[model samples]
Target: MRMVTKKQVPPLLLALGASVLALVFLLAFQGWIAHGADIFLSLAQAGLSWCF
Candidate 1:
């Protein structure tokens, strides 16, 4: 098996950032989102917070 490398981190960070940003903007501007968007963002924010 191959080992994981630091190069993989940037993309995951970008994806997480985008998800968090979109969630924030949606909440502030649109006021609400569909089921999947809401759940996904909640999970992402929890993970990001946990990491930090």
Candidate 2:
């Protein structure tokens, strides 16, 4: 006879993790993250231009 063990995650912890992931996805879909990235990229380009 073979014995099998299954591991289960707590529902509260799973729900919290899922909520955080959903929030990040929502922000990304709404372009909030992209807006910050665009600002950072523009600043980097300006700094490099000054160095050149």
Clashing pairs in 2: none
Model 2 clashes, total count: 0
Models 1 onward score TM values of: 0.39, 0.49
Best by TM-score: 2
RMSD to the true structure for each prediction, in A, is: 13.5, 5.8
- lDDT of every predicted structure (CA atoms): 0.72, 0.80
Q: Estimate the lDDT of model 2.
A: 0.80
User: How well does candidate 1 match the true structure in TM-score terms?
Assistant: 0.39
- Report the number of the highest-lDDT candidate: 2
Q: Residue 9 deviation, candidate 2, in Å?
A: 0.7
